[model samples]
Target: MSIYGYESLTGRTAVVTGAASGMGEATARRLAAHGVRVALLARRAERLDALAGKIAADGGQALAVTADVTDAASVRAAAERVRDAYGPADLVVNSAGVMLPNPVDAGRTDEWARMIDTNLGGALHVIDAFRADLLAAAAEGRPADLVNVSSIGAHVVFPNYAVYGATKAALTQLSASLRTEFGPRGVRVSNVEPGLTDTELGSHIDNAELSQALDGMFQAFGQALTADDIADLIAYTTSRPRHVNLRQLVVLPTVQA
Candidate 1:
């Protein structure tokens, strides 16, 4: 997936949550290459700082803001930091998410709650933190984008991943509603659902049986999508003309039936 002509992304400010690793990290690198000033938001300060340093070394601007998306106060504070450093973010990517697959009968209520907070609640906090900035950018005739990273689980029924899927489904719906409300105002809202991808996401599953099954499935498929693949899609979505909005994209590997 080679994309060209990202002239509009240059000199824009972008806030990317969960920027420490996986899809968020890949997206940050890809956007920085396109000349976007990126703010790296995540709980791991060390990792964020390292990534920021790498971006800086590559002649790109980046700010490492230690933040936990599940905490509204943390997200708010992070937003303020980004504003101070790079001004209002014209692009916001809600990519911080956790997938903990647990069976309903397993009584893993704690895992269920964690997934809800990080996957669903986290996106809300980010949107709330940067809502004004996105609107203001759009009002200024600048391109503003709100990209939410959902999942294929939102549409497919995965046995032990019910709670995780529910949260993603909710996020997908939320993105659609936001598009309706913000589209007229000029902010493009996109919901990106990715199929089987090789990332640390699967490591969060505590269910031993489920974990082995997923590992075997991925091994069989051989070349699952990479984090960079999703990043390319995001870069493409956000770089289109302001009048064009790729509202929903479901990216999947050919091997995944």
Candidate 2:
């Protein structure tokens, strides 16, 4: 533990999904800076490799493992590689997600399905793959954390964002349930809800109108949160003592509300 009473995160192992870009990438970098061995997981191998290389050059331990979170087999294989590289993960961050919002009357079934599968199903896959490792870490009295990156859309209503909101809401509820099941078992479960952040999450939107509206919203906020901002909170949450659990966090830009 540090002099400030915060548990030292040095020498711990962490797994961060969606680590190729945005918040996942930033969180991976932050954790590595704290001396944690990080495993970068995402569908983009090149991005993961570059990030891993950057971490290595900075004198931190990192392993790049390409994975598709929607596929159980892929996540399982990636978990095996993580175990081989850095042993069981003491921290896991489920940050892989998609936000393709469109009006419910627009009948954009494809977008809705993608959001549900990637945002909700994908998180479950990572949890299923790493549950045993987390339990093991807790059994040894290490500070183990499972952080789920949901969005403020889970609690707030937005036009043309019904499906996206549904998936996030489900994720939030799931985190709450898991907290009850895992809290006493020693692993800390945290649900993080971030509001309007400047990330590539909006670049893939198929609906032009909604995309423009999102851009306008960000512009109006003037100072929007960045990936690094959320990373800081995540690092703080995971660095607490074994007995301390920061259950839920809602982070937003000062200008956002």
Candidate 3:
């Protein structure tokens, strides 16, 4: 009766960042359906609460907690709350991110800093905070997974997305490096990269021309990939056999290539 093909996760706890919407929201919903206790994290308290309420209404366990991933102190506080409520997450998903397209010639340094801080810094903060919990789960012989949501843009660079791509590239390397260090200890680390998914990510682009260009690009595929598509992949990756590790997966719309 499990949609994910794995029911061993029934009693596990998962902490998902960016759960207010997009891929993170879909992932949380998917996990809840599989009976995993989910902790939703994002800066939007109301949205988080709404999601938690919906999950509860569906007969799934969920807790909504608000935190800004860009702030280490905020992340730590959210970690403490989850630790107290769930005891330690068996799965952690770093789906919090931002995409702001601006040419280097524009001198929009603030956008670059925001991308680096949220995309890369946020991932590190979440991992560092919940690392001990992952270790504890492994020590108890439970399969644990750390999923970092990246972007195919990391490898395929467009005109003005250099800095954003670099952050994602760094994330991919970070996941790979962590897998080497953590895989031996029974923890799974994975980097998930998706191309041109339809999300609020592109709306942050302050460049009017680039925003229109991005809109045209997103429409080129007829319709871009949905958050649910990526969520399905996330579910499948985490549900793989314990010995099997999906170190990295790049998912793009068929028309992308």
Candidate 4:
């Protein structure tokens, strides 16, 4: 098939967690433009609603679902809602995550737990909630895709990012294993690892020193990859032919080592 043919995603339904902002929002918009029905799942109802409105205005179908990925019940409920509204999702994007930066000795146990809950545990919940549906779609000879958003920290560590990196590393491995196990069943899983993107993800860091350091790093790395960059990669992956599974994609600015 021609490369251009892979850009069209019409008649497909996608559920994007963290669809309220940043990469999640961008992915929703991109997929919607290609004629995909999108279910926007996020904790921020207002943001999701606004995004859904925008997508609708652009002549796309979208559903705004208020959900907290860290909560298993909420994730399952969101999946049910999506299935009810749009049938089985052809694509599932696990983009909900949290990042908290601090030294291990900072006594910030709460922040660490929050990061772990949202990043690793939350992704697991979303994947598990929708696994059956995805596999079912695959069984029917349809293309089913699962995209997990990881981070550069998953491959490389940085100061004050121990917990966050650990969570991402876990997510990376989870995606890899899921891909291997499900590939034979006609389900394709991919990991999108982004580096130093401009997003509100860093705002969760309560430590002043760590926050300042991270901000400085971003400033130095100027021209960091935008959410759109990662979103574009996701669109490309999901739009490919049923037999084509782009397993792993790592995106970063040219300046980023």
Candidate 5:
């Protein structure tokens, strides 16, 4: 059980949601480097195809499936495509999310719904759609892994992030409960929480005041964590032995309190 043993994911198949950009892109790239056959799922077909091409160019097996996580049928179809092309998936990563900054009193119901639907509901769709395959893979003696990407907001309370935080918190709990239920069945589940990473999460914030506050917070931290930092953690966790589960890991910049 060397620390680096999981680094070689040769012959394994992985399904990665939100594989178009940011942490998802980095994670997919890293997994492919380790010889994992990766299925890229995202709303952007062009981006997914481009990424798949790059991975293939690097001598890795890759598939690009365009699907919206918010739609259960779409997710199921994507999972089926992956199974048809690469057998059962040995790994699944749910990273699709949305963040819109607004106060609870502002009556921004649409934003709230979008956040919940994409972040929490989307994760549910992916897990439920793929749970059967994951279980079957484990039954065959090849342990499966699931990594759900959460956020620091999942733990801490922050203004204008009520809906976003709630969604992430729910995802965290879901991952924990899933881990308990599946661990005995030879499936490893983990939640990776990242703090203040430089991504497009803040772009949805249209409120000037809220945007300023968030920018100030990031600046106060001096440097925000990079997407690659989170990707590295996910890669390490997924590479572990069948009996070893990393559970929950929270990563933040040193300057972030």
Candidate 6:
């Protein structure tokens, strides 16, 4: 995507979870390029620091924060750091998620729990941490936004994605509910559901059968969407006029039917 005419997005502070790589990393770079102050949050301190350094070198303001969104305490601490460096973040993106596929017969309860903890619980933790700031921004008549990164798995019932998809489904519903409650307050809540994006997200799969199936299915779709594509979509959603809210966006590859 070309440089965005982000007149409305410039000079805003944004906190992005999972900013170490993939969608989070892409989103951070895109926002920083558009002259927004971006805070990178993830468990990988070294990776976050590297990305932050790159952004700074490119003349963009950024903060690298080592945080685990699954843990409320960690998220809260990260929020404190962001507030100190960039003030309360008016823009927040929940992109920290795990999609470990485990079939019902596999009985991988651990993976299921992991998905719930990170995919759903993690989003909640971040939202709970920064929700007050969002509300405050809206109260101040400032533009505020919360973007949740979901997956097409939420809409389609894939064989092994049952557990992983469930968490994403919950996230989509949460975003919808938040928009309904917060829209009147001027806080735009949006859910971005991307289909078959090319990212490291596939590396977490533990199910061999499921992995092969997904691989073949994706191969059928000539070209998979890239992280930059989704990042652009997210930036566009957040850059819209405060009065305009793209509450739910389902972005899919043309061949992803």
lDDT per model, in order? Answer: 0.94, 0.93, 0.91, 0.90, 0.90, 0.91
Q: What ranking of all candidate models by lDDT puts the best one first?
A: 1, 2, 6, 3, 4, 5
What is the per-residue lDDT of model 3 for residues 1-257, given as tens digits with 9 covering 90 to 100? 35448677688899999999999999999999888999999999999999999999999999999999999999999999998998889899999999988888988889989999999999999998899999889888888999999999888978988999999999999999999888999999989999989988877888899999988987778878999999889888988777788999999888989
TM-score of 5: 0.96
Q: Which portions of model 2 miss their true places by more than 4 Å?
A: 3-7
List model 5 lDDT by residue over 1-257, tens digit each.
47677654778899999999988888899889888999999999999999999999999888999999999999999988998999889899998888897889999999999989999999999999889888988899886999999998998998878899999999999999997899899999999999999887777789999888889988888889987888889888988777789999999899888
* TM-score of every candidate relative to the true structure: 0.98, 0.98, 0.97, 0.97, 0.96, 0.97
After superposing candidate 4 on the true structure, give the runs of residues whose Cα lies further than 4 Å from its correct spot. none
Error of 6 at 224 (Å): 0.5
In terms of lDDT, model 5 sits at: 0.90
Each prediction's total of clashing residue pairs, residues at least 3 apart in sequence or on different chains, is 0, 0, 0, 0, 1, 0
Model 1, 79-186: lDDT tens digits are: 999999989999999999999887889898899889899999999999999999999999999899999999999999988888999999999999999988999999
Q: What's the distance in Å from true for residue 44, model 6?
A: 0.7
Error of 6 at 212 (Å): 2.2
Q: Which residue pairs collide in model 4, if any?
A: none
lDDT (tens digit, per residue) of candidate 4 on 1-257? 46656544888889999999899999999999988999999999999999999999999999999999999999999989999999989799999988888888987889888989998999999988999988998999988999999999998989878998999999999999998799999999999899989988888777788889889988898788889988889988888888889998888899998
Comparing 5 and 6 on TM-score, the stronger one: 6
Top candidate when judged by lDDT against the true structure: 1
lDDT (C-alpha) at residue 42 in model 5: 96
Which 10-residue window in model 3 sums to the lowest lDDT?
Answer: 1-10
Model 6 clash tally? 0
TM-score of 2: 0.98
